[model samples]
Each structure stands twice: as C-alpha cells, then as structure tokens.
Target: MTGEEFQNRLNAAFVFEGANYGRVHLIHGTQDAYSQEVLQFSGHLALSDAFKAVFLEAVELMNTYCRPRVKAPLSEHYPQFLARLANAFHTLCGAECAAIRGYPRPAFTTLRNVFDDVVLVSASLQKVTDFYKIEGIDPNGKFDPAAAKKARKDEEFKVRKLMTGSDSGLSADVTSELSKLNDLFDFEVHGGRLSLTDAMAFMKGTGPLHVLPKFVPQTFAVFMNRFTEVGWAVHRLVPAIQPPGVSMPKEWADRWTLVDESFEIAVRSLSNELGMKVGDAYAEFIKVKFPFNAGAVFPL
Candidate 1:
C-alpha cells in the first residue's frame, strides 16, 4: 500500500484506553479497552492492525528516551539490509495472519524464518559504525547482496557474539532479551519441534494416532513474542532518542512451555515409534547451533 494509506491506517489513533498519567493502558492489557479502541478500525485493515497501537506508542517512547535523538531515517543505519528486513516483516505479518487463522504449524514455522530477520538487523549493526552512513529508503527498497549472503551464511559464533553482547555496544537488557529469543528461534528452525510433515500429520491425527487440539491461541502469542523481541533489538540498534520507560513485554515462555510439552511428547514418542533416525531429522532442518549459557542465554 501507499505511504499515505499506511499513515491513514496507523496514524495516532487512540487505543486500549487513552494512554495516561492516570489511565491504565500499559498494564492489564485493558481487555475492555482493547475492543472499544482497537476494534474501532473497520474494513480490511493492515496486517499490523493488531500491534499498531502499541508499536506507535513505542515509537513515541523511544523518541522520548533515546539520547542524541535524531529524526533521521531507519535506513540510514540499515542501508545494506533494508529490503531483507522488509521482507522479513512482511512474512512475519503473514505468520501473524496464520496465527490468527488458527494455523499453529505455519505460525511457528514462519516465526522461525523471521528469526533470520533478527540476525540480519544485528549483523548490519555490527557492519556499520556510523548511525547514518546510508541515505533514506522508500517503501520499495533495494537489495544488498552482501547482506543477503551474510544473513544466510554467517557463522553462528559471530551472530551469537552480537546477540549475547560479547560484541556490539548493546545494553545488558537488550542482549539478555536477544539471547532468549535466539536460542528458541534455533529450536524451531532446527526441528526441535517437529518437521512440517510431522506437523501436518499431527494436525490431521492420521499419524500421531492421538487426538490433539486443532489450534492454540498461545501459538499466535509465541509468534508475537518473537516479533516484539526482535523489534526490541531493532529499536535499540537505531540511533537513540531515549531508552524505553515502559516495561518490555516478555511473556512467551509461559505459553511456549505448554507447546513444548506437547512437542516433546509428540516428537519424541513419534521418533521412537517410527524408528526415525536422528540423522534424518537433523538433515532436514540443520543449521549450525551456537552454545548459550545460563547468564547469557538463560537465567534462573
């Protein structure tokens, strides 16, 4: 859609109870306000409709907190990776849509793909020292071949360094946030859940031979959690206006713990039942795995 159209859909619309010094929009998620405000949008809304309210609020918050705050373009920092980032966001929107439609398999699968988007953002930050080396980007952005190559083939060790805060001048909070996401992203991308076939079979109930719920709302929540987590990395990487004041939303593991429980049962049981070789599973979804630690990747 055109920039004007996007603006029309997303511009400063009051949502989930007007944000206030006295109002309570941030916490409790304002179930009543969610409908009264967000559902006010009619017609075929942008795919980002669900999170637009919070995202715009985040922009304002970042501007308020970012130091050396500049209204310069985001592309200034990510000139070499703009197109890929857009593609990732677009596909992530699709995943969000799938999640809404109750397709857990695609929701989780596509979430894994977008994790690469997170790596792309992190890697570009590593490659560029200046915040505004590249010029602005339009809605239709150009491809950077180098970025495309590195995003696909960059070593896990290097990516982990940036993500885990072993490199890059990132805050402990952001790196800590990223480490949690990256390890989980690795889990999905590398078949820690189940293969697409297995997923389809499990859904159909023809293979697993057990009745399971067709969909889980938490599946969508899991995808959204990653979206915001990566978005957190991107927001910090951009030139500062200020640091965030509102709490970063971080509730994926609660839902995912349940999903993983089912995953462990179905995947492990099926692997044993079918006599499936570990080699086959690894070969299907292999990506290099990086070592993560208690302090860096997970914390008690």
Candidate 2:
C-alpha cells in the first residue's frame, strides 16, 4: 500500500480493531467536531501530496532492502532502525492528521519524537553500512569494571557526536539541519520546556484574548522536515552495503532518485515558506512535482 493508503487502513483498523487499532483516526466531510478539535495541518495541497507520495516510495524501498537476494542481511541493528523509522513515520502521519483535525499540541510532542528518531538513523548508520570500523577505544587497557560498564552503557546508540564530528556518515547539510533541530527543541525533548498544556495555555492566551499558531503550513513543515532527513538516510543506506559479489538493483537506483527528490522537495518547501532561497546543490535536484492521484492515493 502507499503511505496514504496505509494510513487509511490504519484508520479503519481502529474502528474494527478497537484499542488495537494502530492508525490515525481522521474523520472526513465538512468541518465537524472531530476535525474542528484540531487545526488544519496544511493548506499547501501540492506540497503535502508530494511528501506523502515520496514517503510511500520510501516505504516500498525499505521493504525491498529488507529482503536481499544476493548479500547477507543488513546490520543486526537494522531492524531496530526500521522499527524506529516506521514508528516515526506513523507518528509523523498521525501528528499531521491531528493538526488537520485541530489538535496541534500533541503534534508538538510528536514532532519532538520524530527528531529523536532521525538521530537514531545517524547512530545506526555505521552498524548498517559495509564500512569497516577501527576501534578508537582501548579494549585491553581498560581499568575500572563498574565505570567501564557504565561507560559502555552510556555509549550505546549515540551518533550525535559522530554526526557532529568527523565521521561524515551523513552529509554536512543533514548534520547541520539536525543540529539546528536539536538546538531548537533541546529543552522540549528533555521535558524542560513546553507541554501540551503549556501550548494550550499559549493558545488560550491572557484570559480569553487567545493567540493561535500558524498551524497549517507550519505543522506540515515540521512533519516533513523530520521524515525527509531520516528517510533519506535509511533509503540511501541500502545501496551503500552491497556485498562483494552482489549487484545493485535497478529498484534501488529508482528509489534513491525518489528519496533524493523527496528530501529536496521538503527542503525547498521549507525554504519557500521561510522566504529563503533554495541552495544551489539542492536546486539542481528540484523537480516540478512527484505526481499522484490524490483521489486514489487513499481509499477511505
């Protein structure tokens, strides 16, 4: 199923499956209680459609990568990465849908979680790729038992340092984008900053004279930003791990192009909304559209 179609299935599953339903329950028709409860997530129909369309393609590529015919399986840690990535996608889709339904406070939380998942993609990169590791840690020279164990525990699944430093696993632009995202929401992620209640308070603003967020395009951008970066990494990592006798698939080539296009479309949308110019490198990769039939994209 396409990402959009999958989203619809998830929504339907909820009504039939009850609490076991794993999809966003977005209602249709005119502005009603369910939709009015949340803000409309995006008014940029073309951009929104583009994001979902490419995300579907990325999902297909991931499934293909998981079942390789020639090489050994992807890294042992890859399943963890996929689990988180899929969850992030689910959260992202849910958050955007929620915003369209009018519940943006939860979308804030979801956006923060999405950033954490993107960071995971960076940490898992070295594990999944075919690159050799030269251990910088002194395996034999260690002294303290408890301290060593604690240190090892602490070091698990950490890629922020490597990403920010010299490993260069992620492109410099992606690294920079993540750094900015981290800085922007550091307190929020740590539970020091805004809560859904606090966001509601902001919306409620000063005893009935309320202020509202630019919910539509802004919420869409938040969702797109998180998915595009990590999606690009996970999508691109497949080809980077080909074994010696294994040939790359034409599917990957097409998927790679689609992934890049998706990422570019997202970045360009951000730029346009922010009134900034698209960078030259990404400018070259820009496409007019990643077309899809919206009517058929989701069967609900």
Candidate 3:
C-alpha cells in the first residue's frame, strides 16, 4: 500500500482501539495518544495508508525486539519500556546518519540521553518481568535470547569505544553515545563512505530502515520535542481523568514530584548526550566557523 493509505489504516485502527476502550481507562487513552503521536510524527512523509502500514510495522518491530526469552519474562513496565525503545531508535538513526554523512561529530548529549533512557527502560522492564516470573506469570514466552544478546553486544561495543576512545580519525572531544560510533568504524559500508544525503535516501526507502526516518537525530529531535510536549500534556490531563486507586509507578511519581528541579538536570544530561555545550559560544561557532552554504546540510 501507499504511504498515505498505510497511515490512514494505522490512524483508523488506533482511533478505533482508543475509542473502544479509552473512555473507560484514562491510561489506555493516554497511551494510545502517545503511540498515535509517535506514528504520525514518524510517518508524516508517507501517504496515509503507507504510513499506517509502516507504523504497524514499527510496533511489530518493538514487539520483536522485546519478545521474551526462555530464561526471562517480558517486562510489564510498559511506559519505561516504550521510552527506551523510542530512545534506541533515535540513537541508532542518528549514528547511522552521521556515519553516512561524515558530519563532524553531531552533539553527543542526545545520544547519551538515549542510552540512559534505554538503560532505565531496560532495567524497569527487567524488574517487571522478574516480578511477574516470581508471581507465576507465564515466564516462558517473554524473552528472546538472540535479540537480547545482540542488543547487549551492540551497546557494549558502543559504550566501550565511547568511553575508551579507541577508534582513530574520530574527534577527541567526541564523547557522547552518538559520537562514539565514529571512532569504532569507518562509515564505508554500502560501498563508498556514507554521507547524510545518502543516509536520508536510504532511510526513506523500506523495511526496518523505514524506522530510520524516526531515528535520524535531526528529525528525531523534532519528534522528541513533540513527544515531551505531548507527555507533559498527558501528565496534566491524567489527574482529572484517573480513577481512584490507580497507582502510578514510583519512578513516574518521583519524576512528577521533582519535575521542576529536574528540568535543568535534564537539559544538562541532554547536552552531554549530544556532546555540545548549550552555551552561546557554541552557537556562535556553528554560525561563524561552520556556516552552511546553500546545499550544505545541518545535522540535528
């Protein structure tokens, strides 16, 4: 199906799903809204039908990625798990694009934030899964050994290189999760050195890579900014709609309590993850030293 057709189907399916159950459960509706926003934001370029298909595929991708293993159960901490998945997609996309484009180390703060987000989500999921297993939930069908191993290996490789600075030709200042990959390997895959233009073209194509549209750092940031806004809105609306005795997770509860105090910390964390100081000097450097010509692309 075309992109538009896919998107329409996705929208319809989600709307139906939401309408059918959302009115009864504030959590369900809020979650649905979050998912729908992600779908819409990521697939904005596609035709509606195609976008829906792609969105479904993305969800399936998440399921596949998080499928349970023989030894461990899948986590029931839905929000944290979803957040991690989102951050992972974003990090991978940015790294791939930078590798392809030969961009001089995009900020590391975003990538670090992605890593931290994933770690938190993964930990929360693990906790939930463990809790369920101990409580006699069906534990056999929740873990995927191979996928888990791959994820661990990928993360290990990334973290090691980022922390140790082993790769040559990578900038010494490139310390963020996003910049770390540059040191580990040359962006020579898919024939010649990968460029951002080529990466964008490849991402706009098909399959798992289709998610690349959502993962690429520049676009991903825009999407994330939107997600944060939506999340804040949902958080605000939740109290009004929530039924009595619906207990929120401790982490979320804590976040709400310290939301004001955490804003600056969050900004700093993001800055470190992207590897750029959020000061005016850096902004000036980009404007004066690295002025973009007509065709030159600025990275996210």
lDDT of each: 0.41, 0.46, 0.35
Ranking by TM-score: 2, 1, 3
Per-residue lDDT tens digits for candidate 3, residues 1-300, read 999998777666655344643434554444344344344444222222232233334355334532321233323443433444545554545643342232212322334444433333322222322222222334455666665566555554543343223542233443333233333223332333433443565567743332121224554343343233222222222221111233333443344434322322333444566654432222222222222221121111
The lDDT of model 1 is: 0.41
Candidate 1 residues lying further than 4 Å off, grouped into runs, are 1-79, 122-156, 168-180, 192-213, 231-300
Model 2 per-residue lDDT tens digits across residues 237-290: 334333334433466456456545655566666566665433322232212111
Expressed as tens digits, the lDDT of each residue in 158-228 for candidate 1 is 55464444574455544554455557566666774633444676578766632222333345445544444
Q: TM-score, each model? A: 0.38, 0.50, 0.21
Model 1: how far is 30 from its true place, Å? 29
Write down the worst ten-residue block by lDDT for model 2: 291-300
